[model samples]
Target: MPDGTELIVTRSPPVNSNGVITLTNRHLPQLKWQESLLIARPVNQFRDFFPEVNNQNLTEIAIEIKETYNDYLKSARSLEDLKNRHPELREPYIEVTSAKSQRTIYLTRLDRFGTLESVFFSQDKQFPVDLQLVNNKIDREIPNSLLAVATLDLEGKSVEQPIGAIALSSVEEYNLKAGINM
Candidate 1:
């Protein structure tokens, strides 16, 4: 998936120190050289440091990271838009900013009641608020219990991941419950 950017993935082989594995290297030659050095140092000098390396988990880690970025981007955009609409209250609300291809996104949550309610995101802009575009993949990925709102700004040219989260609560006037302010 390297349209213009280069992507490199390399895996190292597991090393055997005596009857146990000490460390696994991602680069084959580097691991080999380390193994040789360990052998020369002593017969089983590294045997006591036997630790199993889960090489198979690397791909899973990358996939999870990619998903996280995607989710953050979507959330940020929506938050930015919400802020734009309520310009006066922008300072009161918490903000989480994330970046996509070129734009920066802000995610925030506003509490209205005792129960957790809805989440909001911002569209990158100044005047009118733009809601985040919904991606089918992201929609499917989220749990059914929660709803997501996002906004995207293609005109922006920043590339920093937004770092914030929102907790929502439903507003129920009929229910006599005072919210705990922290």
Candidate 2:
């Protein structure tokens, strides 16, 4: 059920030409199985890829990454200088400086070209999440309030922590099984 209530099917119902199954079960009287309410079982054991990001270790890592970038920016004369000094900082970055306040902001581009928003962390193989640094404030894009767990290497490269098995949504699993490339 859409409200998290489970109702067992008592009997097999016939499917019409429109691919709609009529549920004879009294619990959900006259309810036709709509595509939206369908919750198919996962192909394999479900593994939660999204985890709580409030851990002390992750917080410390975020702080460390921000501090390291700030330290490098403070000494570098320009964005090019920062990159040349820290080769670990990958490309496709956006650097902006305000003339009125002389405040500079640095952002690492994480989406496809011309896209206004960052891609979902799971879909992007490069940086797990988009990182933005403005003065002393550091911000990370958390799509749908879901955070992808990752860490920083010794050379300041982003390293995604191993997530056992990628869990796909029911529709995505079906598409994959049917040779679709969604």
Candidate 3:
């Protein structure tokens, strides 16, 4: 782990096996890119990064983002409809800025094989984080695990490294744990 990076641990359910589970630990950097875009934390948590912006204004900016995304989804009946209703949605990425601070965040959406790829955001022209999901093959004795790697690029190219893994729980097991009946 690098300086100012925190480790996040998550559990992954076993696949086609008995009661075995895999746990993954990921390194999360405390950079503005991560704080402002990657994780789903409170807006106030990153206020220091934007000293000029107040908490209330930051909260409003967050709400506006959500509402815009919701509006995009609701009006996305067709490609033409999306382009006509919200011209911004037609672009591969969207850029938003804070009114008071003038701090900007760029959001990029990628898709492959009819499935949504990673949606990355950054506070600069170049993306700072590149994440990938990798499946790890294991023997019959051990539980299966999936690895999530985050490649951080700061200072243009001085520091870049892969850090992180994620585990998903089985639906049946999760339901049982939550006391939900099917």
Candidate 4:
């Protein structure tokens, strides 16, 4: 995004065309899926591949996501019901992001070209521990919140104190999965 903000890029078919992943209605199994299916918050049209502007008012980022099909609602929060209604929206997308509570993140990366990715095993061969294995609804509330992040040298030791938690959401959940329920 030119505004130096983050975007929640969501796509219905979840196409990984070239290096870009999309959650748009452009490519669908059925054309009608564009109507009732692939419902999302719809990212602001200003966002681009990279940040080119220094936007200080970076708050309330409504990231696009694949939600349910409530005609009156902009983005549906029910996955199970959406599944029962639109069974054609298949594959790991609906399966991966489905959650009773909390949230499910399929994967995360740090490269601009998708040239390299983090791996759970050493054989995959990657750099930097950019992936955070957090599974809590409270911590996941903030759109682009930072958590206990630290860097290390080859020996793998904390190079600095992890950054403090930034809660953009004033609606604090002091007890929501407060005890590592994941």
Candidate 5:
């Protein structure tokens, strides 16, 4: 049973003949199903199509999910109640910054983008191999905290290390599935 708090599902803006966008109260079944029933599985499984926007502060989204989950828990009539009833949402927020610039060309290319991403490492400093060992530990021991895929190229100067690419998609995709198109 739904609690007293109403679940307000915002409808999408409809395009009119005159090219003006208009809002309506009509409910879209896709939106409702996606929002109310689609987030139960793990998100790391589908990481390719999602965007990586780490700067997006998800405090609002977190609060909303927390509230809804809290409400569901509170509304539970008993401990033996239905377990598979409500939606299971996942939160995976990934923030990635390249650790090193392979060469002057790579740095110059990155500079051309006009968006200076925050550096993950300190300036003019070298990270010990222990860091990589720790990452390997986390990847192997605590796989849930990270989803890493690394590769060693034929040339020793460059080894590819890609991490946290699927994290943000874990939440952003939920908004899309919910018809928010965020």
Candidate 6:
């Protein structure tokens, strides 16, 4: 905001733990150390709160991001189609992103009514350097529909599970339904 670019800072869009970033509408809590905002729009990607840009670094980053997104989309589509034909797969799944070495994987499974599960993890040697095992297993159902993000700490090979979920009803059903006039 030092550049004097006014940010609406609305509460509807819901920010993530990384704080209110415009592009990632993850409605997680704002931790004390996170600067990522709780609101986002398409332009949030270009909002550089770091420092002045000199070369085409920003452009390059954006290009790589697009490529990554496309790769994920293609993979997800393929997985969905496979799941459709083989309905007995039970819980069909897809791993969204992975590092070059296959040491890390981001996973999501396809569900009925266009719903999908969420998964996230960060890897580091310092993350419980002695951690020999991780039991990343989840299987639960909420009778009342609600939105929730599960948080886990890979450090020390333990996790602090999420307590509750936010409400499902919202003003914005369709993307861009929240008028720009606001």
The candidate maximizing lDDT is 3
Q: How are the candidates ranked when ordered by TM-score, highest leading?
A: 6, 1, 3, 2, 4, 5
Evaluated at residue 130, the lDDT of candidate 3 is 42
Q: List the residue pairs that clash in candidate 5.
A: 92-167, 94-168
What TM-score would each prediction reach against the true structure? 0.22, 0.19, 0.19, 0.17, 0.16, 0.23
- Per-residue lDDT tens digits of candidate 2, residues 45-130? 43365345668997788679768876775665475676664442454443334344443333333342223242333343433222
Cα miss at 60, model 6 (Å)? Answer: 1.2
Against the true structure, candidate 6 has what lDDT?
0.38
lDDT digits (tens) for residues 1-182 of candidate 5: 26778776699555554432222323333354334543444446655655564544664675688788767766664422422321121222222333452211001112122223524322345432211211223233332322333333435665544332223233333321211111
RMSD of each: 22.9, 24.8, 26.3, 26.4, 25.9, 23.5
Which ranges in model 5 have alpha carbons more than 4 Å from their true place?
1-120, 123-138, 145-156, 162-165, 168-182
Candidate order by lDDT, decreasing, is 3, 6, 2, 1, 4, 5
> How many clashes (backbone N, Cα, C below 3 Å) per candidate?
21, 0, 0, 3, 2, 8
Error of 2 at 21 (Å): 80
TM-score, structure 5 vs. true:
0.16
What does candidate 4's lDDT look like per residue over 143-174, in tens digits?
A: 43433232334456544322223222211323
Model 3, global lDDT: 0.40
Task: Give the Å shift of residue 128 in candidate 3.
Answer: 7.3
Which has the higher TM-score value, candidate number 3 or candidate number 4? 3
Segments of candidate 6 deviating more than 4 angstroms? 1-54, 92-182
Better of 4 and 5 by lDDT: 4
What does candidate 3 score on TM?
0.19
- The lDDT per prediction is 0.36, 0.37, 0.40, 0.34, 0.33, 0.38
